[model samples]
Each structure stands twice: as structure tokens, then as C-alpha cells.
Target: MLRRFGSKFLQNSLLLTLSGLYSTAALHAQQPAVNPAPIPLNPSQKAAAIAGNVQGKALIQQATALLKSGQLDSAIPILQRASVLRYVDPTSHFYLGLVYDQKGMSQMALENYTLAIKRANALGMDSAQLRINLGNTLCKLNFLKEAEFDYKRAIEIDDKNDVAHLNLGRVLLFKGDNQGAFRELSRASALMATDPNLPLYQALALKGMGNNEECKNQLQIFLDRAAGTHSDPRVISMAQNLLAELK
Candidate 1:
């Protein structure tokens, strides 16, 4: 169920730091709980399915298949085609951005996200998600100041966006501002326990403040809880290595 709910930003900085988190795959897994009964699609809409586009119901499902199968290389061409179609929706471009990000094609990803952003703004669409994605990408690219501005803009648009807070906190932590990072991470943790990054980041923030014992305990708790969560190998490995060295 990789929906790419808000990963337009990761595409831009995927080469620098490939972290997508629950914003796409993990966030989509939560959808069933939110919408227990999906409305049936109309037959006329079924006829609108791309006829010559490889026989798929729509470009989106085809792209999803490519992504799920890890055939990212094969997906890009199809995604590009979809984006150029007259009837193509913003979601098409959004997922294209996600694919490029996952494939480590930052420039292409950024371009797609920018396109999506423009279209969303034009239609007064769900622009907040695009802002979050762009902010996350900028943060990874080491453009922390600009990324922070995007996150603040997102907050202004949607005060309850927990992912934006988490991302902003991560940037603050990387900037060596432990106190500010802690506040944002704490708020994100309060909003979603599924976010392993919160506790793991909290430990790092504590470590930065020279609270060695507290950091160790928090890291141990995070490691234990994160074991079955499919946490990224890189993130888990880095955190574990850091904790061991700290002790």
C-alpha cells in the first residue's frame, strides 16, 4: 500500500540521504483503519483506464506494481508518460517523485515534486503534503535553513502534522541544537508511537547534551522496540553503533 502520501521532498535529496519513512509505505498501511469501506469506482471511470498503457487499469496501479516489485528502473518511463497525459492527476506526478527518490535520482525527483507542487497550488489542492515533502528533501540536502522554512510553512497550513514536526526535529538535531530538537521530537512522539525515529532521535539528542546514562537507556528501549518494526537497516545500524560507542 505504498501511497507516497508525502514524499515529494525525499525525491529531491534521495541521493544525499535516502530516508522515506512512514510518509509513504508506512503511512499507507494505516489507511485501512481510517477508511474501513472504500467506495466502489464507477464503470465509466473504469473505461477511462489507460488502454494502450500496458493494459493496467491506470498508470498509478502500474507504477505501484513497479515500486512494489522493486523495478524502479522500469517504472520511471511509465511514470513519465503518465505525467504527460492530459488527464493525468497530481497523484500521478506525486508517486513519480516518490519513485525517483527511491531510485536515488534526486534531480528527477525534485523536478517531479516541483511540478506536483505547481499543479497543486494552481488547483488549491492538498498542497501541505507537498510542502512537507519538499521540506524533508531540503533537510536531507543540508539546506537546513530553507527546510526549516518549509516545515514552518507546513505547520501554518496544518498545525496537526506530526511528520513535519518529526522531520524538523531531525534537522535541528543534526544542526547541534539539542533543546529545540527535543521539543519537536517530544511532540511527534506524543502524536505517534509507531515513529521509532522519535525515541531513537531523543536518545541522540540526550547524548548531545552529555546525558550519557539517560541516552543509553533510551537507546536500549528504542532498539528493543524497533527490532520488529522494519526500521531501516542504516538507521538501526547507525543508532546501535553510536550507543555502543557511547557506553
Candidate 2:
């Protein structure tokens, strides 16, 4: 537990020093979320496009199976071939990017996501989400300013994007602007009445603001939830320990 805490602490520090170019969230910036939404093609039209174009659908299915089975390297070629053949559906690109991102191939993930977004950027396009994703990737690469650009644009497009707000809060926290972090995170928590994983952060923010009673209350709630669901052990632990500290 101590080691996990230390590791998390180091990760936060590194996120600040290494990825702190701008105050933007990096949730999916490099590829998936940062990339544009997939344009929906009619299923019949898509099937017709590849009617004689080789077994694109089959290959994509194979790639999916491979991914689910944990054969990442094997899935890559199959997915890429499908992508190159116009057999690549938006779902294919999205999942392909998912695999690439999981493997730390940020550039590859970004490329596929971009392709998916461009192909699917019409009606169903969640442009703001794409910007946030790309912003996240940008932050990881130390392009803080660019990341900031993406986040700000995302806010402009949709101020109510909860993930965007939460991500921005994390970015602020890493930047050591505790007040900024508190404000953003507090808003996020208020919006998170439906999400049970955030009380720990809410507690942290309250504690930072010297609201020990509020912090303790949030911590108790966090512990109660954690015991039932195991959804946030680290947060529960931290909240508990912090509550003890404040006492």
C-alpha cells in the first residue's frame, strides 16, 4: 500500500514536470478521444463497398478476437489491412486505436483515430470529445500549449462536457494551482453525484481548503462505497488516512 501510494505520488510529480506545458486534460488526446468521431456509413453501403474488396469484415472480426485474446501484435496487421482496404469501419479504427494506445503506440493510435474521426466527422461527430482526447495526447508529448488549445476549444464547443472538466481539473492539480484544482474538481464532484469514484478527490479538495469536516464526511462516504464496490480503494485509503491526519 505504501509502495502504491509512493508510485502514485511519483506519477503525479512526473505528470507535472514532464507533461505540464499547458493546463489541459490528457484523457484521450493522442489518439482515441482526441481524434474525430467516426462518420457513419450505412451498413448496406459499407458492405457493398467491400462486396468484392476481399474479406475485410472477416479480418476485422479476426482482429477483434485477437485483441480480446490479448494478441496485440497479431491484431495490428489484420486491423491495418482492413483499414487500408476501405474495409475499415469506424468501429475498426476506434478499436484499432484502442489497441495501439494500450500498447503505448501513441502515434499509431493518433493516426488511426484521425482517420476514424475524418471518415466519421459528420452528424454524429463529437468534436469536443475528440479535441479533449487529442489534447490529452498532446500533454503526454509535452505539447502543453497545444493541449491547452484543445481543452479551451472543447470547452467552447461544449461547456458541460464532464470528462473535459474533470480532466482539466487534473491538469490544474498537477500544475500546483491548488485553488484552480479545487474549483474545477469541486464542480466535477458536484456533477458527479451519479459517479461514485470521485468522492475521494472531493475530500482532497475540501481538505486542501481546510474544510476538515466536509472532507471527513466525504471520506466516510468514500469508505462506505469502497467497501461495497471496491471501485476506489486507493482513494478510500487516502481519504481515510487524510481524515486521520486532520484529527
Candidate 3:
């Protein structure tokens, strides 16, 4: 699967790093083992179906190339056509969702991601990364509870997925589950020691838990790491204000 996107895609669009998208595994051990019964087809029918799939794969390849070149508009129609083809790759819908997300069409992105999930599930290609992507879209739409479910599902699919833990923690923090957020963020920090955002999030969770001193310490750590980096100015400002409040 073409996991990497053009520089214009997902650039500072997510709070977490894009590195997770590339490192994710495509299959999970916990996925259902039962395969769907195969449908019997005559020679001519099977040949036609195989040809259709080949065409779908070709369209997906074309769309992927367009996406990598930052030609989002050109990729959309190709991906759309691929998505509706018989035996189409679920990744066609995933890429479509990514294009829509980059274009700031959140609803369309959410719908496509949902379709991708359904198709992936049917094909036994459901993965933690897929759930994380869907969760992120739901979060953008302010569907916090639904986002929480998807994040949790991602965690279940791959407990070692630090990105899933980080996102779940953020959602929990927003929902006032400070302790839950703290636990998940702590796990994320343990898994990805160098992610500067973890300490910032941990600080927020601590503040919500009335651990002001620990919050201040984490804030200072975040500030130190964020300095000379391309950290979000709003996040830096918020951290500074919180640090001052604890003083």
C-alpha cells in the first residue's frame, strides 16, 4: 500500500507526527480468522471479474501517483472510479479520504473513511492505522465519543501503537477523563520517548488532576524540547500560560 503522501498532505494538520502512518502494520493477530465462503463462478464470469479487478488496481495506481505528485484534484476521479469497481482495493477509499481531508472536506473525508473501514473489514484488512485515521476524522467533526470508540478499537488491534494511545489520551482529556488520559499518555510516553507532545499532554492531564507541580515540570520539559523546533505557537503559548498559573 502507498502509505506516504505528498508534503502538502497532513502537514501540521494533526497534532501527532505523520511517522506513525508509515510504520503501521497492515494486519492484526486479533482479526477474525473466519473467511467468507467463496462464490462459484463460471469460466467467463471469473475471467471478467479478474479483468475488472485488474482495471481497478490500475486506477488505484494512477490515483496514488497523482496523490504523490500533489495533484489531489486529478486523483479524486480516478480513486472514485476505483472505489466502485468490483473487488476494488480498500486503500482506494482510504486514499480518497486522505485527499478529502487535505482539501478540508471533513464530512466527505469521514464518509470515505467509514467506507474504507467497512470494505477493509469485509476483506480482513482492518488495521489499527485504519481505525486511527477514522478516529482522527471523527475528532475533527467533534464526534468525541465516536472518536473514542475508534481509538479504543485501534488500541485493541495493536496495543503497542503509541499513536493510538496518544490520540486516545487527547480525546479522554477533552472529555474530562483526566486519569484515563494520564494513563494512556503515560503509556504513549513509555512507547515513544522522544515525542515532545507526550509531555505536553501529560502536563494537561496532571493539571486536570490537580498535580500542579508535576504539570509545571512537564511543561518545562515540553518548552525545552519545543524551542528551536516547528512546534505550534498556540500550543507553546498555552503551555507557557499554564506554567505561569502553577507558579
The TM-score ranking, best first, is: 3, 1, 2
**Which run of 10 residues does model 2 get worst, by summed lDDT?**
23-32
Ten contiguous residues with the weakest lDDT in model 3: 22-31
Q: What is candidate 2's CA lDDT for residue 220?
A: 81
Query: Across residues 168-199, which tens digit of lDDT does each residue of candidate 1 receive?
Result: 78777767788888888888787773576677
Per-candidate TM equals 0.65, 0.58, 0.83
Candidate 3 lDDT over 30-133, as tens digits, reads 22222333558899988987787778879977877787788989999998887776443567778777888778787998998888788777766667777887
Model 1 alpha-carbon drift over 4 Å, by segment: 1-58, 65-69, 210-213, 226-247
What ranking of all candidate models by lDDT puts the best one first? 3, 1, 2
Residue 159 lDDT in model 1? 71
In terms of TM-score, which candidate is strongest?
Answer: 3
Pairs with steric clashes in candidate 3 = none
Clashes of 3: 0
Candidate 1 Cα lDDT to native:
0.63
Model 2 lDDT, full chain set: 0.61
